[model samples]
Target: MKFALVLVVIIGVVSLVSTILVANRVEAEYSKSVKRNLTNLTLMYVLLFLVLSVGIVWYIVGVR
Candidate 1:
């Protein structure tokens, strides 16, 4: 359980950093449509991460 939680956190952090870097890079060259897409994609990723993290914590606590 500890390992799984840690792994999830690490993956989430890495994904977030990578996303931010890519978004910044693309923002410079892209127009409004592309920027909007990136923004949507980022929001989805954030929502997914939050859901997964909450589920995992809830499961752990319930198990205990």
Candidate 2:
């Protein structure tokens, strides 16, 4: 679960960053919506990565 979460978040960040860089040239309602969604998704991904990293470290320490 920890590794999966990390992969998911990294992918999300990369994909969103690419989309944002590409979408900057556009001026449309759809572009605005996509930007908004991408921003929110990226925040969620950072939070997930933080939580999973802490949880995994805690689990590992407890096991030993």
Candidate 3:
């Protein structure tokens, strides 16, 4: 679980950096760029849920 959390943190940090780069380069409509940034942020949410689901499965099997 600890390792999984660390992985999520790393993913989040990478996402933040990518967002910075994206914002710096794409100077189009602010609304569209904001939408793009949000879409990227969803990746972090996906990562968190994937880790949580895996941990739940692991607990079910290991603690059984």
Candidate 4:
């Protein structure tokens, strides 16, 4: 179904982003620069994901 496909795609992307970008930093030293960079990246990615999800849902709903 379209809903299932969309859910899978969104989850897949989120999982990939978390695994690739966020998980690797857990073992890293949290110096000021590294912490700031990580925080910024996390915020950017979260906002991007939210905007993308909203856009996808809007487009899908409007298409019908």
**RMSD of each candidate relative to the true structure:** 2.1, 4.1, 4.3, 3.9
The list of candidate 4 runs beyond 4 A from truth reads: 1-30
lDDT of each: 0.80, 0.76, 0.73, 0.71
Model 2 error, position 14 (Å)? 7.9
Q: For candidate 4, lDDT tens digit of each residue in 11-49?
A: 867865775566457655656666676677777777877
Task: Order the candidates by TM-score, highest first.
Answer: 1, 2, 4, 3
The digit string of per-residue lDDT tens for model 2 on 1-64 reads 6687688668877877786687676767688677887788778767877897798789888988
lDDT-best of 3 and 4? 3
Q: After superposition, how far is residue 26 of candidate 3 from its true place, in Å?
A: 17
Query: Which residue runs of candidate 1 sit more than 4 Å off their true CA positions?
Result: 27-29
Pairs that clash in candidate 1: none
Backbone clash numbers for all candidates listed:
0, 0, 0, 0
Per-residue lDDT tens digits for candidate 1, residues 1-64, read 7888889889888887787677676644575766787788889888998899799879888999
> Which is better, 2 or 3, measured by lDDT?
2
Q: Say which candidate scores most in TM-score.
A: 1
lDDT of 3: 0.73
Candidate 1, residue 59: the lDDT equals 89
